[model samples]
Target: MTFAVAMYNLYDKPISNVKVVKTIPDDFSDPVIRETTEGRGEVEDNKIVWTIDKLIPEETVLMKFTCSIMVTDITKRRTGPIEVTYKANSSFAGGLAIDKYDAYTRNKFYVDTVERDEEPGVWDCKLVFENPSEFILQLFNADVYSPEDESEKFVDIDPKDVSLLPAGAQWHSNKWRYESEELPAFRKKLEFRVMPDFQTNVNGTISISDVILEIASITGGMSYDLTQVPTYKEQDVIAKLKIINNGSAPLNEIAINQQYFTSEFNPPNASEVTMIWDGDEVDLPSNSVKFDSNVFRISLKNLRNSDTGLFMPESILEFEYPIHCVNPVKEATFESEITYLANTFPLSQELEFRPEVPIIEALHLRRKFRIGKEVIPIGALGKYQIILTLENIGTAPLQNVVLMDKVPDNFEYGSYSGGKPQITDEVGEDTLKWTIDLLNADDKVEISYEISGTGEYSPSDAQLGL
Candidate 1:
């Protein structure tokens, strides 16, 4: 393995006669001095040293080296514990002053996987550790980690708290059991300290690989208005479905089967329901469409792998269709079966439709006045005729229709024409109300009444209907 070391001058003034030394372990051989950024030095007594004449403020130097491991036992490997000694020239002292620095590398330990047991939706891991030094290690601890939301882990170690470890000995940790819908990758970290020298610590890591498969379905649609208490009839409704792949491995030869049903009405006929591709009408593909008594099935093939692979975006399939409804059913349901390699049982998804009725928005009322044969001017005292019209321009019919119109204060009530209106007198105004049992779509009603005004008078603005 190759390693790099870097040194920097942090003082404001320049430093002189700087030397850096790195000690090599006995278990390593074939030491090769690959590259150095500044001045160079040679290996002496298994130590690599470099000497520099001067180092300016904020200057840096880097060194690289490569070596081979001579020891076959993992516990016998040791990398580093570097040291540096330097001097600065002081004008007052008239001599070189010595300063020393020390640095330590992370000691090497061994963490290995002993074995693994696997079954559908479950996996168990076994791990082992080795200590290569002559000294005893204390307070040794190990922990395994997995995604919190995706998997559960259980671990067991032979001795709960390992207070002592003999030289060149191996210890086995408790078997780790992982339970999840899909196998998940895990990380293991081992930490320990050598006895009589608690400050000297060692840490090692191990990674485990896993393979998983995930699929999801999402749906959306539009339904007819129900607020108007509309008369039941055949109405067109649209629905869109999307299928996504969210797994690690490549998904191949994917087949999807979708079924739709209604409880209160017959399933939509194949001739009445049509599929659209890219906003254009098209016949359903023969290889993908299948129909039974009330079930409609659609199949898809060769879906690409999800984003967990080399691809950055997930693989997805989407389609839309319009179905006809002739009854006021409680709900319409759509179900799916997705099958792919290694997943023989197939994944399933169910979606129900219970759309809310929309509110009515098309109600209009108008008022007009005529005096015998001429239009009456404002504030004119005369016998004039008032006409009120209410129209239901909405698509659905209305029930229990009531129209209320307030007569101006200066006008006297007269006989009504066209339709009889219930008249009521208030402190300052009179109100005329007309009731209709039912108002069909695009229906209108007109009511006319004669009124005598004592002073200039026009129709009052207060008019309400339901």
Candidate 2:
């Protein structure tokens, strides 16, 4: 019978010559087929030798061997295979003996490098398998690590969905699940079949040493520095700053500096000037933040009209934000258009008109009087009285105010007892007239005339024939 032997290190350190021997029945011809020793590494002659025993036909012969002889240092771990076979006899078939081996199994490995997402967050990890031989490999369980006081869970990566790289071949499954509530202080272990398939008796096991898992979480948000931008000055044109948060977490008790400033209407220069904010401080909302919310308003009562000597109002105004925000608050801007006119001119000057101080316009009679109801009886002289009220809403009093009323064609002119009567129309069109001596501010004059029925006639009748 022939013998085959293999030797290798579990930790990947290389191993040199390993001895092998086999005993056969005396009837078997002393190892026929000529070839004595063969292997992958350096081998000396007589490494595998057999002695003959002619006396005993059935006695078993022992094959002596001494093999630990390679001349290199075995610090690094390695492994290789060895095979032995017996020459086939006429009656029996040749037998092959083989054993898988490794030189080192307990060598330690470390994480060489680590990479994280540009936008901070936890991400999954991957391992590469390079071992070409079929071997058994094991990993340190996640639960075995520290901070595992909590529950543990894991999910296997689905091969159908995950893309497999070169490392995919040496694994039974492309990915496996490993999770533990405990904090990961130590490296985790992962084990797998050295060879992807068992049908082929391949040699060494390849593994990703000390695999690491990552945790995902929100770090800090964007920040704003105030020292870069200083306080705003009066009359200085400035741009607003903006703060934005697109993340899931909300900020707390945020507030911007109160000393922010923007341009305001200036009376002395008759132009838009900067106005620093000195208003009370304000706090931001818990959930929502306004993109263009107004923080403060600058009064524009100072601008005056240069040519018209009137206060010129600013209809459209632009405002800017402060340098620093409570958090890194984004600067916001807004434009306001007032409903009513604030000032008459754009130049800085004196006040031209103040409606509240009794400034009046004109004193012409707004409307004349004709006192007759819709159903004034046809011919019966419907006794009617007409009244007139004259008002002086101007800045000064009105004098020589004369009130007059014309009598309808069917009525007769009446005598005026209140004032001297002046009749301009000869056909008796004048019914009444009055002259008020004087009408002061917010003052008015009232006068009335008397009339009687003349005769009965339908409204459609052209004239009354007395």
Candidate 3:
């Protein structure tokens, strides 16, 4: 059978340095090179290689070769598919691109014979011929033969009559009935052959869709204490971006641009912002500059596909810098945009940034002591009253607030007021624990306890564990 391999340039621009490689099946032998359209190709060790300098847009390169199928046993005979890989360099699309194609002889034309039913002495068989190729197949002749029985003759199709089979079309033969004393087991001896017009060009269309790119950003460490307004004061702030190619085609000539505005509240230098690509430090693009010496523009490039000839689903780029803001600010914003060339078309995605402020505040714990109506004396030994206050001065509510207060060594355990406190007395010290389910903003809880001084007590001897 003669096989025609074709490579079509689906891109609009001309492709240079074209290389086509084809691998033949093991069952086929003695490949005879018939012709090539643009370049010479030869079969080397069961593989064919063709090199063309350039291929114009919409141009197709065709290579023809002939190989015969060796059938030792009809039931055990099988052939593998022909695999082809092509690569070309496009100037407009930035560097090399690759594509693969597989062609199977079985996919082109095949026949199947199955036994429908079998009675005591009769057998019914059905034969079907299928054309699965994209182009029309001109079937010259087809025949079924049974060599075991002399009564069963060979069914021959007229060679002069040509049958045109459309793409994805099937042809069924008339059911054949065989009568015998025993059931017909037509498994090993049944054989079929099909002769089709093989020198014609099999045409098909190739569609190259536009590339689709999605970009997302996540800001880290954007929280602040509610006691003061959110400020960026020599603190590290990170912006993580996830760029992905969600299209069928590869994207190239990629560039990412981010503009960071620095005012009196945020005075981050352009050099201070370090750009990391896939965990490696990379130099910024030429277009990156510090506009007006305050507004910085960060540009990155060469974000293309990997060696596997496909773009990665996600490419992470992180920008980290130290923010120096002396005064508090309501908010800070930045803008980022990604531009790339996909299928020879320019595409871009822009993202608006609004830094997030986490709802977290600093917890305050105050401890004070008094004796009767006045503050505790320096060396008083009477009963002393200890006051503990836990306040939540943040913008958000605090959950699961546990306050642990340790009593002094010389103080004796006493009853507490205002809140129920779990007291655990150890050998040397005692612990007073208070649990609050929720503490809203500006809310405070005070717990007071009276303890008698058993030994010589001083102000420095009293230590509050919070």
Candidate 4:
């Protein structure tokens, strides 16, 4: 969130009145200036203003500040279009220049002559030009003469174009040889301009574009395998949590924490949990899992390593563990609430999900029935007391129950129990039926009947139906 502004002086002369202003984002806090190279910077209302009195040639002024985003969820969070206003005597930022001209100024121009002893009357001469004024100067041409009247030319200098010479600048002409009878002396004529009056006024305004910073967000859910579990028993259930990345930035260092009541459920230790990343199953490292009394927390600095994190754009991270349903005496509902928060300094997004365990209810379901058939020879042969009984012995109710028993081929119905039954077989062959609308848990029912037959007394196993 640190912002820096640099103003460079790309001119031959000093520039003045450098005022730079940058707009701060609405969600960001008031900025505090960190450092300045050659300017005084201050924070104003929703903006940072910087001012510099003057900047010498080749001088650079730098301003820096940190812009930290404190609060933001809105889509459009943008920063400044930094508008800069500066004025210089003559220069442009885009490396452009105007036509060059010259003006008059204080300058020096002369010639030096030297004679060698070996060659009689042979002299070497050169012309020198120096600018000692406070203004820039330009040189066009220079010439030298030996007779002090320019009658005989010794050296001529012309660069074909005007040469820019700044203040305190000096120039030298090429050497020329001359032959003289006496000690050589020379006069010079120079064409030059002192750059003082031909000045240009320059004004500029520059714009530095701002940038958009995206926000990071997260969302997810938790669930359990069983929705309803029968009471009076302990059961193992699988619990899973899914976290999805739905932000513009990648995420790292996740912590998943959950707490459950010990009376209703039991969370698994770290060794039993498994992790699935991006639809691929993997082992949940033991170091990442932590378990306390009734709460467990899982920590992961990243999925793979320090360099890797959540997938770019979007990815899925899942965790699963075995949880047990505590045996209960009555119907009860178990709930578990887990929290997921990204580890960020001074800023983080948290997510929560409540996954309910299976509901336990009172249930009783079992079936046990007894049937008996007895015959007693009381007085005569083939004339005996026939007895048949039906009983229901079960812990649960038997609804719409119909018990049926068939008589032998040679036997016939003579006497029956409290309720009479309809004949269901051929003539002289009948089936005894008993009907019960409802039978409570741990309840029993019994029915008896008497029959006479010519063969031995035998009855098949009873059949019960709705």
Model 4 worst lDDT window (10 residues): 457-466
Candidate 2 lDDT over 1-466, as tens digits, reads 2222222223222222223323222222333333323332223332333322121223223332322323132122222222332211122212443457444333223222222445233323334333332343432222222234333323233334433323222332223323333322333444332222122222322221321111111111112222221112222223332222212222221122112222321111212222222232222222222222333322333223222122111111222333221111123221222111122222211111111111111122333322222222333446554444566766455677666555555555454445556766543545345567777767655554545545652333212110
**Which model is ahead, 3 or 4, in terms of TM-score?**
4
lDDT of 4 by residue, 255-327 (tens): 7888764665677877889888888887667888887777789987764354344544367788998777777
The C-alpha lDDT values of all candidates are 0.51, 0.31, 0.51, 0.69
TM-score order of candidates, top first: 4, 3, 1, 2
Provide the lDDT at 101 for model 1. 32
The whole-model C-alpha lDDT of candidate 4 against the native structure comes to: 0.69
Which window of 10 residues has the lowest lDDT sum in candidate 3? Answer: 210-219
* Cα lDDT, model 2, residue 318: 23
lDDT of 2: 0.31
- Residue 337 in candidate 1, Cα distance off native in Å: 12
Error of 4 at 150 (Å): 99
Encode model 1's per-residue lDDT on 1-466: one tens digit a residue: 4556677877666776777777777756777788888878677878778777777889888788777764332232345566676665433443434365333323343333333454566655556666667766653566656646323444333345654776777666666555556545566667776654222112212221221213222223233333222124445454454444343323333333434445422333445445443344556446565567565556434334422222112445444554444444332322322222212123322222222223221122222222122123334446666666667776546667766666666768667766777766532347777777777767776777776766665544222221
* lDDT of candidate 3 over 1-466, digit per residue (tens): 5556677788666665555555666767888888899878877887766667777989988888777765443233233334443344433444434354334344333334344454556666555667776655555555555647645544445534546667787766566776666544442222223323223222222332322222222222232223223343423334343343433333443333333434433434666666665567766543553444444345433444323233333444455554344433445432222222222123332223343333221222332322121224333456667777777766556677767676676667566687778776532457777777887777777777776777675534555445
Clashes of each: 4, 46, 0, 1
Listed per candidate, the RMSD to the true structure in angstroms reads: 29.1, 38.1, 22.0, 20.1
Off by over 4 Å in 2: 1-381, 413-417, 426-428, 456-466
